[model samples]
Target chain A: MRRVLVIEDDPKDMAITRNAVLRAGLFPDCVATGEEALSYLLRNDCAYILVEPCVKGLNLPLILSLANKRDRKAAIVVITKDSSLTSERKLREMGILYYMVKPADDMELSMVLQNGKAD
Target chain B: MEKPISILLVDDEADFRAIISDHLEEKGYQVFSVGSGQEAISAAQEQDFDVALLDVKMPGMDGVNLLQMLKEIDPSVEVIMLTGHATIETAVQSIKLGALDYLSKPVRLSELEVTIARALEVRHLRRQAFQLRERLRQKEAFPEIIGKSRKILAIQQQIEQVAQTDATVLIEGESGSGKELVAKAIHRRSKRGDGPFIVLNCGALQESLLENELFGHEKGAFTGASTEKRGLVEVADGGTLFVDEVAEMSLACQTRFLRILEAGDYRRLGSTKDLKVDLRIIAATNKKLAERAKQGQFREDLFYRLNVFRIVVPPLRERKEDIPILIGHFLANSEVGPKPPPPVSPEALESLMDYSWPGNVREVANVVERTLIVSQGLPIRPQHLNLTSREVPLVTCGEKDLLPLEQVERDHIQKVLAAVSGNKRRAARILGISLRNLYRKLEHYGLANSEPLKTAL
Candidate 1:
């Protein structure tokens, strides 16, 4: 089974994302803060990393760089409330697999993670 | 026939209450003055009041408490609090308890009247917004045609204009291009909107079956005719009867339909009595109906009668700009997926725009629904769309080279004129321009004779 690292500060959103990942036949390693997410990435190997950009203590670009160094194959998916195209381009340039705005359908996230990449 | 605005005045002082009540009555208001909060509650229980005035300092059940109680009784009642010993705390408390407004004691009669007027205006606006929301919610009650293109705007205008009369309407469009939606719009807007709107597809049944289904059969009229049946015409008596694919109606059936169009009367098969019904007929066809009528395939007289009001629904490809809006609407309203269907990716939207939807708006709905299921819990991408690589033709101009702007306009006007058989008025309507403007263009292009017709104004 694949392992998914779920990083969400919101308790409700984290629970929903964990459930979706578990339902997609993947084990979820959950964290509430960006510092915890960075430490978890350093100590563990996971197939996918799900994140929210607005989490406390989040350095999204640095987190993306660390994830890339730790596991070059990890597919980083950013779910954020900022729907600006500038942010999307910056995230995409950092090699994130997908950028979903807030109110992102949980079911789609499960499918995207299950399939590895949306392409 | 308008009812007077009713106001309930509650003030402990008898002399003050009487003076205010008399002044309100002189201004043509039905004023009900009560000496105590209990009496005001009793009066409210007996009948409804549009507005209520409560004194903040009262003997029992003060104004703030009474405001809460009155709101509980009828949330629609507008309550204004009056205080002789005015304080910010009591004013804030009164408003927090749902008081519409608060005023200090010794308020001028004119000032009080202005407050009442403002309260009534607010209530009126709130009711209007609620009614508008309710009407929008009823979108599910009828087929909603959604598009913002000039072609669609013109069609909507035509529906509104034709809905005011009982004229027979002919809607011409390609297959799957929302002709039924236009018919329903006309019916829903007409005076007969409250009445039943029935539909019958002319192309669905064979000639004999179609006539039997339309006119219905009397008992013993045929071998399987065990009982008399009411036709769609009778069911739609007070409203509208929409006939779809009417060009496919057989010649024999056309003759029978012509009778109803000419005189609102039709007899059941094997029944001698003529049955009359009052109904408006709106017919739709995907075929070139005027040409078909001239070719002796359809009844020319029936064609002329049904063409009293003509509405042309443009094909989806012409309104491609509305594709994103339509897709969003379909995805949001779709029941296929769980609540909140996944969004479409930008690449997927571009692919959708590239394809020529030969089946028109209906095809877009089907594609969206199918993609929702296949994509599951993920944003829809081009792979989920599964469309073949077929790009829509940009233009169908005869020459590969681009024509000048004036020439393109002239050519389009000439083609539309020929399609409508040189009816300038109908051409102008289809072109979405004023009749005078169309005439000027025609003269500028030298398409029409210099000698204008008498009705050319």
Candidate 2:
């Protein structure tokens, strides 16, 4: 199975994301902070990186740059509770393939991850 | 037609239900008022409701229980709880139980309208999301089949079943019923999906041109043959060749094509050597090829060879349930002018639904395009359609408007000829008359100097 890295600070959201990723036929490696995510990326290569923009100790730009540099084939996905258009624009500018809001049904989230498109 | 928003109002108070129903009906919403929960469930089972207002304090099957049941029946229907007494616990519980909103009894009319509007908006967004997901899932395979009716679903299943094999497929349907789309879907799902898909319309050319196009001539084979050209059959090697209007093939071309179908090889017009090719054949016809074969018009052997598998696409009139969905799809995707086309009124939709679409799906698309131009960003009404009669009537009963039968016939002939850009063959076909007969009529009518009019029925 393909591997996906999920960075989420909240326990409830982490569990939901982990289950959704598993349901999409991918292995999920969960981390609570950007630092851990960066370390994990340095040590391993994954097909996708699903991250929450407000994760603890988050440095979105640095982490995205490093993630792209290390795993050139990995696709970045942003899942957050914030539905603000500005945040979506910034994440889009950072070049993410998927952006999903919170409370998205598991089926929809899994579909997005498998299809690699937010819509 | 834009469907009216339907609401299900369940309250024991007859006066309240009547007043609310009147208000909603005034706003052009279809309201189904029920005095008890059982009636509401029965109503829900009968037809789809966009929103439901349930009274929390009902005699039996209270609001919360009814909410769960309704959600079970159709999860997409938005529900709101209405109670005389409001409590924090009940409100939170109602929200948790999937009620979109909770309203206290004797609610202000303005507030109720606002809440109902919000619920409708949410329902719309949810529906859009569901449709998007469905399209995305099938985007790689056959996204062209847009209808969800039973007939369309059956056709989709047939496409999936036939696409797994390399057997020859014969698709039969009315004109403009999307036979080519089904053929392409089969090719896309086949093992040779990476290979090219070539299409040739047999009715669009003469016998000689069709044969030459299918099987090219060698260099110096003919007076105008300057270079050796590869035929469509050769180009479609390792792929699929879709032959549209195959019933129109002449006897000579049919004989040559039968040779290829039987032997898997064919010789060019001027070449003695037989060229072998590995290609799947998919043929489509709007006419009954079997009847043609029985009448000695179409080759029987070729018909049987191409009929290894058959998919019959029903006409638009047979599946009227899909009309609304097709209209939505066309309106959303058409690039005639601005970002969005004007909304279609209910009366116009009813008119469209009642009319018999003689030209099938293509006619629907043509009507939509024409209305987009005519409406000019305003709400589309029945007058904007201008359907059935594409031109002014030439034989009205009024004395000044009435014309002689010969005059009317002559004018109509000229109009049809102009519509088809003076293509006499097509004009004859559209006029349902023979080419020779049409020529004699044109000569007798003296229609040599008539100007072309860009209109067609």
Candidate 3:
């Protein structure tokens, strides 16, 4: 079982991701802030980190830096509502393996997780 | 016959007039009585009184003269000759002069009140009915934005959710994909609907002009600034400011705009005082802002700031199901005469679906409008469509003897496989054939040494 960490501020979005992960038969531990997520990764083991791009006080750059420090070999997936080619290229260069647009269907999310696990 | 029911009492008898006023006031009616004929004329000038009672025995202006003057003031003012005499011819002459009724000595208030009430009710109902008809007429005259496609419905849902809040929204889509329409919808649905909805196109002007356009300038801020002016931001105070093509805004302007977003205040171009405005910012862009930020063209901090909430409008090609509906809508409203040519043929629609719409919704609208103009009263045929062939055309290899279907298929498969490089798993996937089938086909075609096949694991 792979441990997945989801950092999101919106309760509704967090719930949707949590339910979708469960529906995909995967366990996802959720946090509302980036600080909480970093602490969780430091104390426990996580195979993947899913971060919302515009969370309060936990933007993409900050989250990427924290993930780099953990050295847990966890794959990072940046979720954003604005899925431009620029964001994709930047995230790819930052060592984040995948990027998904918000409101992504269950099938797309499942594919990303499965692909990340394989990688 | 019923004692000329309504009467306007005018007298110089202080005690007698008070008694008449009291009696008239008791009954449910309107009474405009004055102490003198001069007062009577002034009161009648103000509004049309149903009846007027004048004293025939006054000093300067007698009842006869007052009655004539009142008639001159308003022909509609009913005059009731009031006198202390029983002269028959005087009464007959008064009646001849258009006096409604004659009252002898004291007048009864109950009779006058009932008659006036009945007359006023008729007038009130007529006005009420007229207003109701006018309101109904207005409602039917205007057409509303219509459609219930999932894409449109989703946009409507987002409008409803974000409209009530003051959060900044970033609308992303290809040009002509209804970005402005969505912005308008948000403004209309928001609490700021009654407030001004100001739109500033960031692409239309240079950075200096745009800065001055957004933040007002004092007199002589620059060579062109001969007079003081309030910018769109200040003008849209207490409402919404929609920045269209926001990605085109210069970095200098973006920096200032970011501060306004954070502090909710900004200083005029040449003014020292910072003007605080309460407004909702709704910015739109066709460019990928995130990608621009990555390229160092757009500020990363500003991108994150404006991207508090994002509504991505799907391009027209993604939602082909809506094309026909949009066509019908645009056609119905088209200036083209009644009875537009026949509906678009199935073949034309199929061709349209195959052609990628690079310009998105705006392009689709332009094509529809152009088709209507060119094919007036004729069925819209594929030939009439101005579709550009952008897709790769399949090559024809023969004059009479065409290349074999298997050979063409094999060649196409080999091309795609080489492009992705010969990972059998990926190559087989791209060809939409089983790996075993692909391998067998390669052997049967005697092309097993194809570069893609060599790298096959």
Name the lDDT of candidate 2. Answer: 0.83
Model 2 vs. true fold: TM:
0.45
Supply DockQ values for each candidate.
0.01, 0.02, 0.01
Supply candidate 3's per-residue lDDT for B149. Answer: 71
TM-scores, one per candidate: 0.50, 0.45, 0.46
Worst 10 residues of 2 chain B by lDDT: B389-398
Clashing pairs in 3: A86-B291, B8-B51, B8-B53
True contacts kept of each: 0.00, 0.00, 0.00
Model 2 clash pairs are none
Candidate 1 lDDT over B205-283, as tens digits, reads 4566567657866766765444564566766778888898899899988998999999999998889999998999999
Question: What value does DockQ give for candidate 1?
Answer: 0.01
lDDT of 3 at B353: 71
Per-residue lDDT value at B272 in model 2: 91
Chain A TM-score, cand. 3: 0.81
Stretches of model 1 off by over 4 angstroms after superposition: A1-119, B1-143, B392-457
Note the chain A TM-score of all models in turn. 0.90, 0.90, 0.81
Q: What's each prediction's clash count? A: 3, 0, 3
lDDT of each residue in B1-457, candidate 2, tens digit only: 9999999999989999999999989988999999988998999998999999999888988888889889888899999899998988888988998999999988888899999999999999999999998888766455777788999999999999989899999999999888988988899889977876777677755566667667866766666454554566876778888898899889999999988788788878789989998999999999999999999999999999999999999998899888888887788878674576778999888878877777778778778878888888888889988788443324446688778899889878878888888999999999999999988887787765656566755
What lDDT score goes with residue B355 in model 1? 92
